[model samples]
Target: MSRSPCLLLLCLSLALPCMADEAKPGHMVYLRAVDPGIVQDIRYASAHNFTGHPLDGYQAPECLLSVDAAKALARVQTALNAEGYGLKVFDCYRPVRAVADMGRFANEPGDPLKTEFYPRVDKQDFWRLGYVARVSNHSRGNTVDLTLTGPDALPADTWTPSAHPVDCTAPYGQRWHDGALDMGTGFDCFDERAHTDSALINATAKANRQRLNGAMEKEGFSGYSAEWWHFTYSANTQKPDVMDFPITPLAP
Candidate 1:
């Protein structure tokens, strides 16, 4: 029952596209596929995160977001590029397993990254203080953690845990340099200084935060009050369902 060579070639061509479409479901799309201009740091996929180790379910350092959210983010990228600024995403479409892992790490009775990420907050109080949660808006795929970066944004600074650790409350430049615009505090800084409208930050940091908020808001995304870098798209047709899919690289 072998098909002719021409027939087999036609069948293969028809099936390839379908297989590729099935590979990545319609709900979640790799952000780079939708908008290559967006920068991605994807901290959970690397040891540079608060856990001091890579989190679960991050098979690749890629940003995955719900289809609608991805489209909205692409629009935001377009708007920011015009202003000579760019968006650098730290996290997007977090997995349920990763959120659960965060809970476990928070309760594991250790503070390996405390000085870098949560200087003022105790690990045991992470859930109580609204830092880590059993469920996350990120799991729903509409939320994103991001910051602004200019053409001259710096790269992440080298850190050695054995050295006297710098407090998360340290001045932006003095602490970890994430190559992003000085937004008062580094990402995952569990302190009042990371608040979206914190008055203690310098003028430049305040302006940078405001600019980020404004740009995100213009694209119909709302900022979280506690974490200035957090935002969720609000124009979605339906409420997002929590997802636990592992983030893997998309097929070429």
Candidate 2:
């Protein structure tokens, strides 16, 4: 006997995996965990993106402050999107597993400086710089790692795709934000030079760093002393759990 269309639809629902609609209310959410939360409500800021990759494995609520951080990010997204640039997050609401991964990888006695994670720094120096901490604010779901991109002077709807190439050895140049200013080192630079207000950098780079810092500070977000690309909206708020969740895209 042939099955009815309604019956076939029901069968399909059971057979296929369901994608989450939005973020959960109180529970810790990650790229891996999903619940019957609301749809995508947070605005995106693409200004700080690399190679046009989606900021996967990101979870709100935990990544963002309950009220102020969320609003500031929304405004940040709006301001950037208006200029044809939006945010692309690399991580948000990191799970405990992820933090463990960083720690495990850090403790592994091997050459990681030549590796993609910390290409510029020496394997032994990473620990001294505190770039690879055993515990990360990311686990608390308040840390974010991002970069700026193009679409400069174009309408948001007509923004063109741009690539963000990260080379460890290359001299830091104007990769993004043409007129805004330079932040001494590139977004991912792990050297001590990436400090928010380092005196070792050129005057122009210092000014540029200040510009970015001011924008983030106004929104109540503070920068990580080591890495200019890192920031947390809720300076003190942090979660106990750290996890490693892969970035899975939402299906159409």
Candidate 3:
């Protein structure tokens, strides 16, 4: 006996995986698809990032990560939600092309976003300063740059070409408003103050960093000391090394 079309469709739904599990290249999934509770501010997808221009290979502002990593992140979000705090990711699952774009920008002659992103440092020295790496772990799909947010977090601002750029290391209230708790400095701030354990920040910033680090650690995410917002979930499902998949938008 042949099955009806609708029945066949229902059977397929049960037999195959959901869009979240298959929309991405091998084992990768959008973080929001897994946990919408976590906020996302993918600056590299827009002019709001240090690159000034949108980075290459970022077709959309979506946070993509390895399956194991996304599940670990979701667990962290659940834990933070209970405490009235949430995770806000800035970058995830970057493409290798985007990393190359960063290197090209670093070697170029212009510094349009200098005031806001790397004020005190020169762009040419980004590699030496350890701000821009020739090979980024983000391409591996398990690393993420994120911040913590709570009820009192500042409101994120709308960025435009005409918007004035503020120093990333400027005091919390004076810097670009990203609706994140003051973690010493803004996300991607190349200044020493952005260091996870920098002593220059006030008591509040220190406490917030500690809290965010502790929460991520509890979920098995390793925090990068040089960048307060950087974390990596060690158990990656995809293992061919750096990925080149473009971050495409979810089906509307």
Off-target runs (Cα >4 Å) in candidate 1 are 1-24, 158-165
Please provide, for model 1 over 105-213, each residue's C-alpha lDDT reduced to its tens digit, 9 standing for 90 to 100.
Answer: 9878777777788877788888888889867889788999999998656786654545456666687667778788889888888999999999988998899998899
Alpha-carbon lDDT of model 3: 0.83
Q: Mind sharing the TM-score for model 1? A: 0.86
Clashes of each: 0, 19, 0
Tell me the lDDT of candidate 2. 0.46
**Residue 81 displacement (Å), model 1:** 0.9
Question: How does each model score on lDDT?
Answer: 0.81, 0.46, 0.83
* The candidate that achieves the highest lDDT relative to the unseen native structure: 3
lDDT of 2 at 82: 62
TM-score of each: 0.86, 0.56, 0.88
Clashing residue pairs for model 3: none
- Best first by lDDT, ranked: 3, 1, 2
